[model samples]
Target: MTTPLLGCDFSSAPTRRKPIVLALGTADRGRVRLERLEKLESLAAFAAWLAEPRPWVGGFDFPFGLPRELVEHLGWPTQWRECMRHYAGLTRPQIRETFAAYCDARPPGGKFAHRRFDKLAGSSPSMKWVNPPVAYMLHAGVPLLLEAGVHLPGLHAGDPARVALEAYPGLLARECIAQRSYKADDKARQTPERLIARKDILHALEQGSTRLGLRLKLTHAQHEALVHDASGDSLDAVLCLMQAAWAAQHGAPSYGLPADLDPLEGWIVSA
Candidate 1:
């Protein structure tokens, strides 16, 4: 049986404007070959996809958990399962209100609490987006991952075939560009320079100029398709693809699942 490779651009509310795009590929001799891209616009569609059985590995661009401190501070359950149950039960307004109150009590920088993962892995809260825009991504992505029942490597082991790892495009981008801005959804900042920078970044990845030792070989058409997407959606998805590629290289069962992920502390990328 051929193992299908998957990369996802997830959204909390996956609609036409913000759908979950899954890229399927295969690995051969350490190279990942792109085969297809699938987009699901609703939770129902995604649920169907998740229910299917397949030997696959995927990198999903979303946070798996919030800081343990944040959960504890709110008097919420510290265990991942209980926390997710409690969080899923609350309305969006209630979640925002609770988080907002936490922020109000703490100083500006101390708003979102941190965890051991934050310090070790160097990631922000899933709710923080100003600096990296990941806050919006977390808000848009995590819930759906939960609903789909995909196995979150360190947090929850839902499915063995359907493996999910937390991946950040910036981690790959910075490796090639070193602090250069590549994309901006904001029209004002989508300057020619930024576009060119994005192109260059894409080119670098295509040439395998990173630590993963894997080159992202895209056709000219595919290159154009990735470069022209100003919102960075396609690019971000491909970034995840590379992470999946790296995970595949390790010959491990799954990329980020540790032998022992804390049932209460939750999982982050095992960087």
Candidate 2:
């Protein structure tokens, strides 16, 4: 039997208003089926779900590692596990103060340190604390993954059956729609244009038009559910699902990650 697959659109601080979304599915050949979508409204609930003893591979939309340059400059632990343990101990304010100070000391053009993978994936630096607040996301999320003891391909050794890979939904979304805005958190900003973009992305996924060569199979209701969420959380989860499918189809162990990936800075799968 093929291992079940999951793709998560995570939130560092989850609540009923904006919960973490998981697109649960299974991939066969080059086609991926959307079995269901799950929303966890609390980090505690998310942790409980992660601890469930099951065999599956997941693509999670969170930075699995920080920029090595930033870590070294901060004098944090060099080893992946040790670094994460240290990071997990800091308060969000502490993180903001430290990262902000580092940015303030740097030149304008180079305010934030970046991982090599960030450039390749066009993702915000893991050290960025605001706008997207990915820094807080990393601060809140990675520790939970580690606590769950899921295997992080090149980074940590854990339960091989329960594998987790760092995923960025933007990487796959950009492939379909370029830079067109797709979804918005603010109701006023969730314009028709963004809705149309969501449709376009779904259509492209259904048709397998992107570079991954894998099609997404969704039911009629599933199709509507994904397009209607103006926040794009569900759609983003599905995008991560497509990425997970590609990685699974490409073969295991590395799951399409580069062989030379930085051990201290985990890579985005399919980047």
Candidate 3:
């Protein structure tokens, strides 16, 4: 039997308004099926979920580490574990102030430092604590993975059955629709145009048209749920879920990450 795969749309401060979304499924022969999509109502709930020992791979939508440039500039530890330890100890305000100072010292268009993987994956700078607040996401999420002793491929090898990968739904979403918005957290901002974009993305995934060569098999209810979720959390979870499926298909030595990946700055899966 194939072990399950999961995709998480994480939030630093999860509440009923912006809960973490989890897509649970199984993959077979390049096809992935959706079993359920679970919404974790709080960060505590998310931590509890990871405590269960399970055989599964998950693509978590959060940066696993800071850029090497940022780490070195701060004179933090160069090792991944030590760097994470130092980073996790800081308050959010301290992080913001430090990052802002770092950015302010740099020239325009290069204010924020980047990891090699961020450029390849077309992801936002991991240090940005606002907008997406991914810095806080890392602050909130990475510790949980570390505590659970989950395998992080190149970064920190642990349980093979419970692999954790950095994933960005935007990388895969751009495969179908470039520069088009698909989700909005605010109910009023969920527009019809974005709804159409979501459908287009779903159609592409179902047809196995992307580079991954995997088709998504969703039940009628599942399809409707993905479409009706104007926040795009469900679809984003599905995208990460497919990434996990693709990684599993290859028996990914580095979980579909490049061989030359930086252990300090973790790579995004299938980027």
Candidate 4:
């Protein structure tokens, strides 16, 4: 019996315009055969998926916590689980007001507090609300994972068979195409060029040419489906799926993290 790998592209508020995307598959030796991709309509739906009986290892694209500096400055709990509990309790307005106050006190360049993994992986600051709104992603997503009894490897212990790791698809995508714009949420912006880049990315994965050393096997229909979604949600989910595959292949003896991982700020796998 092979273990399943799941990758998720999350949204704080999912609608028909943009929904939470999931990529599901299993690793066969060196190849990851993509079985299906699904778009969940609501947080309730996403939560139901998490609570399902099938044991899965998933790479979820969301910040697991705020930066250590930010947490310390605000006098929030230093413990990871404790911090999340505190965070999940606060209302959205309370959160925005608190973060806004913190940013206002700092200088322009150094205003945003960043996790160590943000520096290493070049991810958006977990506190940023405007650009990617990953702050909301964490608020919306992580608490559900906690409620579902999913184990977050180094951060939280739960059902060992139901593992969840923080993943940033951009980390893998950038390796294949150095910051080249490959996706846009707007229908008008989905150009031929971005489609070609997606093709290149798909090809690279199929050829077993990534640092993770795993290839992607997809049926003709699946290949078309991955490319047809110009929004890149599907592709992002697959990138995360591959990252989960790497962690599965490696297991979590190290929890697929650096030895010096901060308990206050969880590390992003393959960052």
Among these predictions, the greatest lDDT belongs to 2
What is the C-alpha RMSD, rounded to one decimal, of candidate 1?
2.8
Residues 62-146 of candidate 1 have per-residue lDDT tens digits of 7766667777777888878777777667766666777777788888767777655665555666645455445445554556667
Candidates ranked by TM-score, best first? Answer: 2, 3, 4, 1
lDDT of 4 at 34: 93
The 0-to-1 C-alpha lDDT of every candidate, in the order given, reads 0.70, 0.93, 0.91, 0.90
lDDT of 3 by residue, 1-271 (tens): 8869999998899899889999999998888999999999988899889878888899999999999999998999999999999989999999999999999999999999999977777899999988889999999999999888888888997878799889889999999898899999898899999999999999999999999899999998899889889999999999999998888776746767888989999888998
Q: Each prediction's TM-score against the native?
A: 0.86, 0.99, 0.98, 0.97
In the range 1-271, model 2's lDDT, one tens digit per residue, is 7778999999999999999999999988788999999999999999999999998888999898999999999999999999999999999999999999999999999999999978889999999998899999988889988899899999999988888998899999999999999999999999999999999999999999999999999999999999999999999999998888888876668889899999999999999
Per-residue lDDT of 133-191 in model 4, one digit per residue for the tens? 88888999999999999988788888998999999988888888777878999888999
lDDT sort, best first = 2, 3, 4, 1
Judged by lDDT relative to the true structure, which candidate is superior, 1 or 3?
3
Candidate 4 whole-model C-alpha lDDT, 0 to 1 = 0.90
What are the runs in model 4 whose C-alpha is more than 4 Å off?
none
Query: Where is model 3 more than 4 Å wrong at Cα?
Result: none
Worst ten in a row by lDDT for model 4: 250-259
Error of 3 at 181 (Å): 0.8
